[model samples]
Target: MMTDGLDGVVAASTILSDVDGAAGRLVIRGRSLDELAGRTSVEEATALLFDGFFDDRPSGGEWRAHLGQARHAVFAEVAALDERLIRHGPLEAVRALVARLADGEDLATALRLVAAPAVFLPSYLRLRAGHAPVAPDASLGHAADVMRMLRGQPASSVEAAALETYLVTVCDHGLNASTFAARVVASTQAGLTSAVLAGLGALKGPLHGGAPGPVLTMLNDIGEAGDARAWLEAALARGERLMGFGHRIYRVRDPRADALKRALATLGVEAGRLAQAEQVEAAALAVLKDHKPGRRLETNVEFYTAVLLDALGFPADSLTCVFAMGRSVGWLAHAREQATSGRLIRPQSRYVGPAS
Candidate 1:
């Protein structure tokens, strides 16, 4: 019964959060993600996360804007390095960029820490495929800068709003796997960037946050609407866990899904793709309802994440890094929270495999 590290010993109540997995609800500081996502900017979410952890949040748009500027400025430092840098994978190039920013201290350091992957990772992906990364203009909003960099073009207000919603929605969660990993690194007093690197590494695992982009691939390969059932059946029959249908923590439909689905709909999702996606959701839900009825294996956040990001033109390969954009805020907030608590997080582990 000891899973992973046997570290799950009923952790004491955390003012941090409460996730009702069976209900698929999350309460961050007593506010629901749905209520928060629609009206919040990524900046606002960051403030809420650090509300208790920090007395001074970069107040208003200042902290968010500052982080945006810092990410742009630091990433630009390496934009010229793209030619040779592209030879390295996006993740590696990203790690190097963080290393370069290791010198800055104050707010600049925190900004660079939060924004490193957001700026560098997308740029790295572009440079690898012979595309140029766009330079960031501080005047632009955070979501706009992200979309502009990812697409190499300016973004409309709708695009910016939708992307910001995503970044905010996923910005923080009660200590999930990746956030906990980040806190573990942060507990050592490692730099914020170091904590994030740990999170990204954990997220890269297929079982964690890596499956959303693939969900789109599954949808595409299913192609015609008629093939969804048979194709999904074959995939399931072969023991493949259908990518977007279930969740490790949520039981009912994921609350994040509704938030994202609402955002995607507001963005007026792309024509046939959205419709196809709707159809796919319908078919998949029908199947899961019949096959795993008691399990509550409904569409999770990843289901809508694929649809939303694809609508925004993110390549599947970039999804993990894209996810990092939103989730990084949560990582930093949690790291700061844990650090402020002064607990070193030394959990006990039971060894089972043959302790030499």
Candidate 2:
């Protein structure tokens, strides 16, 4: 028997991360999610992911310099992309532009793919907002340079650390939709660029990485603390799904949700909005319990993800692009893993209709 969405189907073996849906646990490279998110930087997580894979892997001071150089190397490409491509949104433009980088399965290609968004996103967003793009500072850390490029100034320690938490928290999960897409592309012997482009395309879907934007929209609509329950009730009455409250996998609270909430609390910006979200979360959880008694619809990562990104001054629409920045590391990691299998990812499909 086949599952409709390939549910519960074990595709391939991986040493990267594991998603224990029953326990609501995410373990990356043998470390718990909580231990990695707030404490580890994205650069550190990248090193963890590429530990046994890449031959030219840099560690300690060398890794930071290598990554910083890669970011600086991509500046011209970000600036040279056509202005018209922004019509498809920065994320789509990012997908198209990544294809312009050299194709390979080597460490250099992996580093460049990882660095593309850190350079491309801020540059693209600034240019789209009618400002001149800022160049990357090769001396700064990954999250710090992203913020620097965005604001044309150094980020506060709090802001930079929050962004680092966000990036590391999302650096890799289980074989999520986008990662799976990347792996499938890689299985076909396609280059890293093609695999990453496939991942970006998959991530663009609303069911996947697009919900964070609407979580903010929902918060905006509710407006006040006392209004959350009533607003949520009316929404549920209209059969509208709450944006951040449910997940397809986790039967308990999403582990990343707490990690991100903690990250936002660390930043301590936009206290009023954060309080409002907390109230909204409590109200939504209570209401959902009363409404869908049998279902486990708890807060997921995107709930606090929205709050933190908003606190950092990112527009809601750009949340997905920001997500891509962190997740790009995971995509490339999975792509490289799949490419090593030496077996194409060809699964048999059963025809349900007339066999002509």
Per-prediction TM-score, please? Answer: 0.90, 0.97
Give the per-residue lDDT digits (tens) of candidate 1, residues 1-356.
Answer: 55674344453346656778877888877788777887887667766766766554576758667766776677665655555666765555666676666632234565666677778766776777678777776667778888888778888889889898888888766667788898888778776777777888887777777888789889888885468888877777787888887876776888888888888887764767777878888888887777776777888888889889989888786777778888877777777766667477787667669767
In model 2, which regions exceed 4 Å deviation?
Answer: 224-226
Alpha-carbon lDDT of model 2: 0.88
lDDT score for residue 51 of model 1: 72
Error of 1 at 39 (Å): 1.0
Candidate 2 per-residue C-alpha lDDT over 1-356 given as tens digits, one digit per residue, 9 for 90 to 100: 78888899988899999999889999999999988987998888888888877777876668888888889887878756566787777787787778789889988888888999888888878888888889899899999999999988999999999999999999888878999999999999888999989888888887999989999999999994458889999999999999999898999999999999888888765777878889999999999999999999999989999999989878888898889889999988888888886478898898889878
For model 2, give the RMSD to the true fold. 1.3
Candidate 1 lDDT score relative to the true structure:
0.75
In Å, residue 251's CA in model 2 sits off its true spot by 0.2
TM-score for predicted model 1 compared with the true structure: 0.90
